[model samples]
Target: MPLQDNLSGYNSGGSDPSLFFLSGIPGLEAMHLWISIPFCSVFAVALLGNCTILYVIKTEPSLHKPMYYFLAMLAVIDLVVSATTIPKSLSIFWLNSREINFTACLVQMFFIHTFLSMETAVLLAMAFDRYVAICNPLRYTTILTNSMIAKIGLVAFARSFLLVVPLPFLLRRMPFCQSHVISHCFCEHMAVVTLACADTRFNNIYGIFVTLFIVGLDLTFITVSYVKILRTVFSLASKEQQLKAFGTCISHLCAILIFYTPVVLFAIIYRFGHQVAPHIHILLANFYLLFPPMMNPIVYGVETKEIRYRVHLLFQGKSF
Candidate 1:
């Protein structure tokens, strides 16, 4: 009897799958070529965009401020996040290489979750930068100094690593009795978690705990920072000043929505949407990971005047 996957309706050859199989898109394999076009295009754009932001920030003296520092960090993170899954996803689509070893899958699981958490923390840090720059202009530089930025980066990586490193170990100890096919593009945490036959309550609980702890807590602080920023902007004496103050936040606001909205929706649906068609869940899961990396550089580069000016200068044969 062919095995049926609850989430994706994917079928497996054997009752006990030795290697995890990755799907490009469930029920849409015939369109893999067409799908690969967009995925590849986005991947290229993400790489080029992030690299441009990093290069421009690195070479431009004026972009050495805390906000640009945070943006550079974001560019690096977006590059990693996009790299972790997109290549393999494209491989699955283009070369028909859908199999992934358990060890390899766990590695993918670790990087994707950990780096995304780092991105979240970096976003929060950026929000704080905005908050201080708007609310306490004189103190912005003194507060978010180079050393402070380095420390914030350190904490973001450390916290994400410590919290998420255990997840792969937890999954490793579990035995798989059902089809080990991950119905999504990459080895998504919950998608892999659902394959284990043994008790996964601990894994499930811990995953949720980490997600809430990192995402929930960071989003809260970012919200508070933004609210304060809004108050400061609105209190500016002139309408032009208020608009200018508020304009600086547009990129970050877009980033917050582009990143978090899909994440929260995906997390909720994965946990509780028993009735959801697997394709929708899988698409939402892919959206959260893919969309942000492709959008972040575009968002920041277009919104931040200094970066845009430098980019134009670079194109016009201007050095540095």
Candidate 2:
């Protein structure tokens, strides 16, 4: 059946939908103000932490290696993820302004998905960076040159943008005859599409395909890289050298865990946890988006000596 015909039965009224209402937290209206406080704090920390990482990376010449370069990219992705969701979420919580224009919602969804895909790609690239540094130390610099880094960055951005560009249009074509109320804090693609009156099989299928092909593939590569890294580390002659080599990966591994674990969990819950409480789904959705940006910088700052040193210098008012 044709999509428009399938949606023709839906009573969309005479006017096309122009705005969407975001349900911040169902049945917890009284606690929204209190809720916004911690959310605001987390958002602030994420912004400060990521911005600081970017500033330190930009100012410090010695931190211009492939690993740090990937870190910088990850910082940018974190910033994008935070920015796309937090401010509007704060507005929804504090000011009670929940109506988002159709165009703005589409824009937000595009960037969120784009940057998320880019983040996975960046993490994969970082894993590859670690693999080279640990397994092929002598050729690390030669392999991951400035040009190569730029190419990787370009490819990541392009892949994400191309893959997600169709999503907004797909949603736009659907007739949202059901309530225009998004049940989560931000403008998630699935949340928006679920309101459509027409068959959303294509959307669901495409979403899963993107998840499996783009994100799943990245996860597989990262796991393989780490497995290889572990093999190489175990074969080292000295325990000190083994520990030292593994130490460099601690931050990246922590980052991978923080970013991917919640994402997978949320996906599982969204797919199979239909009986779960609405608040559980809502909270998990928010956490999946918020926690990584807030925690990634802290993890990297504490685990990476170079970043820590540079951050310390900045706090001491010393030039990098």
Candidate 3:
């Protein structure tokens, strides 16, 4: 775990809970309201941007394609990601309401992890979409039809759901006797698990397995897709053609970095940086979740030609 627990070992078997108290950050409670201002601003932008993406993609028939369909799915996941944690976190920051029921905490934890895995899978699916479009241009439509897209979506959801639904149940059997105060604003899995009195190796090991299998494999496939994409792109005869081919992938590349960089950083910190302060971990954890939702639509809106045009017309009050 990235967070350091000063009182972890003593609480052996006494778990009593009407609630678990959440914190914005352990030591920076005094500045939570100030901290929330930017958080709230980001949330607002995410809400508006993703909603715009959904609306634009849905309203424009020209925008309907496998690529745009994946973008719409990404937008929806971003909305769910924001909707899951931000409101409760804001409540803790603004209203000084920190108590979350045990069951509610479990639910929050479940959504957080589940959606994170789903995002990885979605990104992987998008990578595959790009792969087929670039490598098999003539057959792209045949390869990624609506039925295939639906199946892909279902697989992503099932993979994430099966992997993450166990996390809350794993914690449910453990007794949280150490302290009711969760070290972060939401019920992060390790944060909640650390307060447990029972042996937690099973939960911890399962977490490691999930990370390795899902993120590791997803990133591996994404890398392979991009490599093949680059090969086909460079094989183009003209420099202009090459640039155009590569340009189409820029937005997705940005999204890949935005989503995976934090996961990589967190993995390093979790495994090797246990000496770091809880406040720092909390801040980074919150920022990790915030950046993607806030940035994804912005990235696509600017880098995607059709979306940019649609957004322009929308702002100018042009009819869809």
Candidate 4:
């Protein structure tokens, strides 16, 4: 009934599948110290940038509108996502502390997936905000009131929590007869699930279903919303007004691309790149997780006039 015996085969003996070993760029363990430096820099920037976004939005009364509210929600989600993965990954890379307790790993996975889902929900809400603003300008304020924003935020949180709560349990129930060494830097859902010695057909199918129903559906709605916004913009009589209207969405669009493109790439590689280099897969996975949090604030700070103005004033020691 010992763990060593259980590792040979599932259900043969009782194994404490309660600990896992994390790896940092397999076959390049010697370079883990060097890798930690860039990762640390990225983490610092992500935290600082998201904090700045939160501060600017909170301080600048003009940014208290629905769009900026959604932006602030996004910053919060980015912060959660970054915090869930970066610290443990850094420890593994820098200190060679690669062992993680099963419960702690599950907790990390829960927060990561929950925040990711919330992010998609927030983006969908933002797209709706833009749609209403452009298509029904007169009712924008009335429709997306403070109360409505609160309701939407609650729904996003609830949806993410309800859906992802099953994932950790699902993983926990699986028999891990194989090695506990995870090939990636973090405890991603698919990465952890793939380690189970039992057949993972159900887990794989469920993961794909969640992706299609939750993330894919949000993307579909966001795209349709943007198409409608574009039509509305083109219908404007004044060219300048049309340009101004379209410009407002550039930041959100860029943020969407930054977040989703890497994700889609990682998913594709996970499914079809069985023959690809292990390092390539590891690097892409880390990039997808870290890139958005680090770049989102930079995109918003530069693209949004109000945020840019507030940032400039903050740097100049001027009052808002």
Candidate 5:
């Protein structure tokens, strides 16, 4: 049998609840029911929360502005991310030694990359929206028309699809002659690529370059955009307008901080932090990917009055 076939249900060590997928979820901690329960709970919350955001934006005309248009895109990306990782995680908690075929792993990896790519693009779009609104108020309408926004969304999805399409092909060509045990919970690009017994210098280099190009470049632009936004907000005619703009940005800022902080930490841990504590690396990975999706909608609902009110009305019927 090929190495992939051999690894169908292979456990690196004796079946410990922590190391093996107890039910069927990969990298799930079956022994630590406490941890698994919380992870599942938050995963459900993020899925539902992002879904609700999409529903509300689709239904409500008031939220059809450029800002909310970008927000709706963000909601879709978060939903994809949550959906992609959560089931595999839950399977580990519920089913012991669950098997995922090589094809299935490739599919999961594709979605992970696609959603992450879209997220980076949406963040950039949001930054541009704010820049136009605050910095060039007169042309905001002209620049961010409905057709234009739709084109932006299309471009983002196309970019994600094109970039991630080659990943599975690369994986298929590589020879995994030895270990099939993946270190990370999910079929992360780096984690999976590292498992190949043959040299993966080209794959690793391409992966690193792509990550830096997407995440690093996006972050740099976002920072520059925010700096310009701050300058514009400060120059506003009234304190009230400035405060409102600041309030509008708070949720986006919070999302950026949560999203980026873990990414940087993960890079450090995956590279240097590995020597110190293995569990620390795992814990950081979980937090970095899982926590932001769970908290993003909650933060937006609290900071954006429209979303908060709509969500409240959704739960509390009409009479009140």
Candidate 6:
């Protein structure tokens, strides 16, 4: 459909929108410009930070371990997530800014979910790595071999790909009889689904079920793994082992909290709170997407002494 005639339903006086597929909100040009600065900054940082981590791990043989492998995987996924969103975001800033074609919107939704699920899987893998190191230290080498790490990375990527692909397809099949203008900046799945013209009973239920399955399942597994880890830590023979184990995990825990809490809180406020400032919600939503990339390197660099030293050496080399 032509853009002008396709978008002629902004004044129908009904609460619903006019399109049949997932379209972004209108009138976000200024807001899009405002967000582009931070989005670009974070994108550059995530790319550099993750690339540097990958480089340091690749160059330094001593740092070639299971933990760093998973960290590198995480950096790669963060880079993917940031890259997926930023260009579309920049497009929004330059173009009419709200006219996301149905096809491109679906692609964005796919990658967003894929990277998010991948991050969850990576975190679970990290937790399992911690579990082995803390709870089964004697067999850490045998347990997390290079082949095992490779397999785990493959499985994580595969599962994320499988889970995320189905959702965008399901969404694409739905008829968006209503709103074209998504209230939020990006083409988030729920925000997109809510604009569907057909009955969204299935979409809403599926979204909730998937949320419970992916995020809920990952959160459950992570909690159980950490509980076991905490138990093992307390039973350690020396304070040094205990402290070392605790220090290694503190950053992951912090990252998890920082990433998940805003999402949960946003869900609650959007569903229940009546007075949510659109700007506040928009900022928080952007934070939900951007903050983790910013925090990942900082958390790892600060928490892991090895990574810290590696970063320092990189900087020192630059100085020389």
Model 6 alpha-carbon drift over 4 Å, by segment: 1-32, 94-96, 318-320
Per-model TM against the reference: 0.93, 0.94, 0.94, 0.93, 0.88, 0.87
- RMSD for each of the candidates: 3.1, 5.1, 3.8, 3.6, 4.7, 4.0
The sequence of per-residue lDDT tens digits that candidate 3 reaches over residues 102-139 is 99999988888888898899999999988998889999
In model 3, where do residues sit more than 4 Å from their true spots? Answer: 1-16
lDDT of each prediction vs. the true structure?
Answer: 0.88, 0.89, 0.87, 0.88, 0.77, 0.76
Residues 46-92 of candidate 1 have per-residue lDDT tens digits of 99999999999999888899999999999999999899999999998
| Model 3: residue 257 alpha-carbon error in angstroms | 0.4
Angstrom error at residue 90, model 1: 0.6
lDDT of 1: 0.88
Considering summed lDDT, which 10 consecutive residues are worst modelled in model 5? 16-25
Q: Per-residue alpha-carbon lDDT of model 6 for 202-320, expressed as tens digits?
A: 77787777666888888898899999999988988899988987887887898788678877887787678778666666667667787787779878888888888988989888521
Candidate 3 or 6, higher TM-score? 3
Q: Which residue ranges in model 4 land beyond 4 Å of their true spot?
A: 1-16
| Cα error, candidate 3, residue 285 (Å) | 0.5
Alpha-carbon deviation at 62 in model 3, angstroms: 0.6
lDDT of 5: 0.77
The residue pairs found clashing in candidate 4 are none
lDDT of 4 at 156: 94
Query: Model 3 TM-score?
Result: 0.94
- For 1-320, candidate 4 gives per-residue lDDT tens digits of 43224334323322555777777687777798999998999999999999989998898888899999999999999999999999998997877777788789889989998899999999899999989989999999999999999999999999989988888999999978767877778888888887887988988888788877888899999999999999999999999999999998999999889989998999899889999999999999999888999999999999998899998998899999
Minimal lDDT window, size 10, model 6? 13-22
User: Could you arrange the candidates by TM-score from highest to lowest?
Assistant: 3, 2, 4, 1, 5, 6
